[model samples]
Target: MGKLLIQGGIPLEGRVPISGAKNSTLPVMAACFLAQGETILENIPEITDVDVVMEICREMGGEGEWLERGVIRLHVPDTISCKTSYTLAKKLRASNLLLGALLGRFGWAEVALPGGDNIGTRPMDLHIKGLSVLGAELKIEHGYIRGGVAGGKRLKGGKIYLDFPSVGATENIMMAAAMAQGQTIIENCAKEPEIVDLANFLNAMGARIRGAGTDVIRVDGVSELRGTRYTVIPDRIEAGTYMIAAAATHGRVIVENVIPTHLHAITSKLREIGVRVEEGDDQIFVDGAGLFRPVDVKTLPYPGFPTDMQSPLMALLSTVKGISMIVENVYENRLRVVDELQRMGAQIKIEGRTAVIDGVARLSSAQVKASDLRAGAALIIAGLMADGETEVSCLHHVLRGYAHLEEKLTGLGARVRRIS
Candidate 1:
């Protein structure tokens, strides 16, 4: 196992480029199944989830390779087997998305339930409801989600109203509706930029989609899709992470290659905490003085403070002034990192879905473990701000999302070393 030993008190400076959006890449990879020929993708993040998704594609008879530093070539051919093995699907929660793509392509999909972070109970009921409305028969037998088209091998068009603006359900329904026989409308769809990016990429390949970055989405069924080369949108969450890290460490970091508008929620929060934030064309500058004010945060869907960033922001709030209260509205069990942060002498209390954090002057070094991906990143940032050396174990979780994280931190003047 690889672990990161972070030596604290370095102000991270220099320019760092953001990687591709993980949320967009997953659906775009699934979009390969709809292509009649090969699809080439650019700026792919070198995360473990990428490899897992590639394995899923390979199992379904797709070939892929890294064409460049951040480019991938995927060929699904004319036909693909529509089975997602239990072992494969359990690697990540996004694996459930293959069901919609496979069902649209082959009229059947027998996949296992997805597994990822234990933040909360992410239900597939919305996904099933949206697909079932398009004439799919879904059932959970043993541990596998067995589903297929009922009447024919074609998907019938229908309107799907989601109970929540779930990212997964929105992507799943989009994939299923892309190749349907008629028209499909999805109401209250997720309005995240990643979802919109996926829709744009699919539309480039002859899929008809409209109103992506809005609550309402409309799709017209297409007869077939052709190969297309596409570049993924920059990761807002990763950009937000770096911005928070800069704030927590009293560092001045100019993060580049990001959509400044996408970071409105994070940027606003940082400004509220007395951090000097400046935004330019696709870049954001954060200057910190190590002094912070505790603020209230309630995690919500897009345009609201994201739940993925809750842990990292909490780490930043730990060393600030006053008490900070964070209510996790998106995930019930997202406070998995609360215990680990406390190991470093953080004053945080968990009361049900709310986390009450009392500010401390500084954190002392401790050997802590990463509970999940985002939590792992939060701990790394905490370690960077701690008073002494902090060793973070179970680092594989961190690698599932961030690409070359230590290298990026090292570039920003952080004294972090990875060891076996």
Candidate 2:
């Protein structure tokens, strides 16, 4: 096991380039199964989650290799296996996406139940419902989600209305519907930028898809899909984390290679908390040398404040002047990180799905363990704002999402080191 030893009190400054979206890369790599030729992907993040997804893709008979730094060459075969490794599939949540891609391609898929950060109940019911509506037969047997189209035939497109705007479900339905027999319309679907990126990728390969940035989406099925090269969007969640970190430590940071519009939700929240944010064509500048005000945050789907950022934002809010509250409408147990933050002298309380925080004048360093990916990042932010030293353990979770996190923070003048 490894841990991050951090000495607090340094203001982070300089440019930290945002990596490609891990959420976007996984589904796009899974979508490669729908095509039958070479697909080149650029700006892929060097994260453990990407490694897991690529391994799963290889297990399904697709050949993938790194062409250069942040570039990958994937050759999807005409015929691929429908069964995925249970051991590998359980390692990450994106493995569940393989069911839709494999089912769309081979008309059958036997994938294991997925596992990732234990933040909340992320079931595959919506995925199965959408796929089933698109003419798939899904069933959970043993530990795998088994079944596909009846008689091994092509999936027929049908309208699917999601009860909630689940991002994974929306992407699964979109991928399966892309190769269906007819037109498919999805109502109340997730409108995240990653969803639009996936739609753009699929459309680039001849699938007719529209209304991606809205709650409604339309997909006209194509008989065959050819591979195409694509680039992924930058990680907005990572950018938000850095922005919040700068505020917590009263630093100036330029988060580069990001789409400013994609971060409107985060930027607005930071501004509300008295942080100065400037937007350029593709970069966001965050200056945090002023007093912060306590604000209420509610995590909503897409266009709203993201649930992934709630933990880190809460860490920053802990140093504000007054009381702040964060309503986690997306995940149930996300506030579980409050215990670790409390170890660092943060005054936080959980009332149901809401976290009531009383901002402290300062925080003292403590030894803490990262419970999940985003929570791990929240600890690092807290460590940077605290006095003395803080050691954050269980770095595997943080590595699953952020790429070269220590190096990035170090470049920004934060005193952090990885120790075994």
Candidate 3:
């Protein structure tokens, strides 16, 4: 059992480096299954999700070990197995990534359904539909998602129009298509940076991937893929959460080792709330300007306001000047964090899917629990803004995505300490 004890009202000031994207590293790790030899992945975040992904690979007859702080060396044998462990598969939602990797390498797969932080119902129907398009036979029995790609079956690539541009579906489809017998075009594909990172990883492995950071992507199937070293992109959600922390606590902080393009949405929204955001080539500086002002925001897909950022943004808005309305377009139950925020005396009301947040002058210290990953981020920001010592439980959810969050906040002069 672990908790974060945060003393509020400190002006967090200093530089904090953002770690590798959990979103990017998980799928990149999954793509190692396509390789026959050793692959080196750099900037791998030391998070719980990565541990789960590593276990998945180890169970699938692959060997992996961390060479450096954020580097992983993995070797998937020439003959890979299609069967995966049910216990490992269900530990992390990203384990479903094995479907495409297994299909690409062995043309078959049998894995359990994914499980992780319970934000909402993240159905895998889109993944199934895209796999079916890539010529896979799938069936749901009991609690497992069983599928095979080689029952005298040919995965001939074709045009796939997704009903929704879900990120997971797009990545899985792209991975499978990269090894198909023909060209594959995915329409309305997810344009998230994580998807682009996955594309870059596949391309590095001798797969032809084009137009990744767009609505449509094209993949030309190759006979085989070779292993190579890849560096994962920095995490934008972690950067956004720290940005909100700086502004909420009336602090000045510089977040480093980030992609400026990936953080455009979060920076734009923060500036709207009177927080000063200065962007450099690989870093961003945020400063609280005297008092914060309220700003209305709506969560959308990539290049728009991201759903992953809504929680931290809500925490910043809790003590701003006026009321702010936020519409969550991505997840159905993302507003569940509002209960934890209310524990700190923040006035917020959830109506259906939208949340109306009334900013108060201050938030009193209170104990709160994290319901999910992003919710943990929101609670941490709330603790940073509270008037006294605030306690946050469920540090496991926070550890899943963030890497050394407490240490970084401490560098920024925040009174944050981890208690186990």
Candidate 4:
């Protein structure tokens, strides 16, 4: 594991180009199996999670190579292995997405139960339920999800109503429904931008998908999908993380190559906290030198405050001059970072799903450990604004999502370096 040594008290300034969305790229990469021939994907983020997904793809007899920076050429085989090893599938939660693509193409899939961040209890019941509704027999036996259509049958699409707007379930079902026998109607689906991106990628490859950015998503099954060149969307969570880092340090940063509409929830919150956010065609300029006001935040489904951003936003709130309340409705254990923040002079209290933060004048440096991906990001934001040097350990968590994190922070004028 690597560590990040950061000297605080520098206002980040300059343009930081956002990387491709990890959430979007993972599913799109898995969707490559739905089609044969070479499928080119641009704007692929160089992150551990993406690499892991690609490794899984290669293990299944598919070929993948990086044509250039942030570009990948993937060649899907006519037939791929139906089983994914536990060692590979346990690397990330996105591995669950492969089940849909594999089942859609091969009528069978045996994947291990996924392992990712320890944020909360992320159950696979929804994923199993959705696929079962689409005519697949699924069973969890000895930490593996073994699923297949009996008698070499293809999945037949049907109506699936999610108990919760689970993004993983929505993406998994959509990928399976893309090549199913008939139309699939998914109600109360997640409306995240990544979901829309996956839908667009599948559509480019000849899948009839509609109502992506809404609660109701309709997927008209096709016989088979063809290969097509597609580009992933910018990482909104990464862009928001940088925006919050800039805001915490009272800096000015222009986050480029992002869709402004996708960040309305984040930008509006920043403005509410007295930060200046100016939106452009594909960029957002954040100026955070003004006095910040404490605001209440509630994490909800898409078009609302994202749960992934709760930790970093809370770090920003730690430096404000008043009390703030954050309600994390998405994940139960997301408040795990509050203890680490408190070690750095933050006044915080967690009561069930709610967190009460009493903002202080400034925070002093401390040796902190990151427990999860977003928690690592929150610690980085805190380190950037601390009074002295801060050493952040467990950097592997951060590298799982953010691409070129230290380099990007350096480009923005922050003093940050990786220590092996």
Instruction: Show pairs that collide, candidate 1.
Output: none
Error of 4 at 326 (Å): 0.4
Candidates in order have lDDT scores of: 0.90, 0.93, 0.88, 0.93
User: Per-prediction RMSD in angstroms?
Assistant: 1.0, 0.8, 1.2, 0.8
TM-score of 4: 0.99
State candidate 2's TM-score.
0.99
Task: Kindly list the per-residue Cα lDDT of model 3 for residues 50-116, writing each as its tens digit.
Answer: 8877777787778888898999898888775677788887668898888888887787788788888
Tell me the deviation in Å of residue 346 in model 2. 0.6
Give one digit per residue, the lDDT tens place, for model 2 in 1-420: 689999998999999999999999999998988998889999999898888877877887888888887988787797778888999988789999888888888899999999989999999999999999989998999999999797789999898999999999999999999999999999999999999999999999889999998989999999988999899999999999999999889999999999999999999999999999999999999999987899999999989999999999999999898999999999898998999999999999899999999999999999999999999999999999999999999999999999989889999999999998
In model 3, pairs of residues that clash are: none
Q: How much RMSD separates candidate 3 from the native structure?
A: 1.2
Q: Which residue pairs come into collision in candidate 2?
A: none
Error of 3 at 151 (Å): 2.8
Sorted by lDDT, highest first, which candidate order results?
Answer: 4, 2, 1, 3
Can you write out model 4's per-residue Cα lDDT over 1-420, one digit (the tens) per residue? 999999999999999999999999999998998997789999999999988888888888888888899999988788778788799888899898988998898899998899989999999999999999999899999888997976678899899999999999999999999999999999999999999999999999999999999999999999989999999999999999999998999999999999999999999999999999999999999999898999999999999999999999999999888899999999999999999999899999998899999999999899999999999999999999999999999999999999999889999999998998
In candidate 3 the C-alpha lDDT for residue 59 amounts to: 74
lDDT of 2 at 342: 96
C-alpha lDDT of residue 170 in model 4: 96
**Model 1 ranges with Cα > 4 A deviation:** none
Question: Could you tell me which 10 consecutive residues in candidate 1 have the lowest summed lDDT?
Answer: 77-86
| Superior by lDDT: candidate 1 or candidate 4 | 4
Can you give the TM-score per candidate against the true fold?
0.98, 0.99, 0.98, 0.99
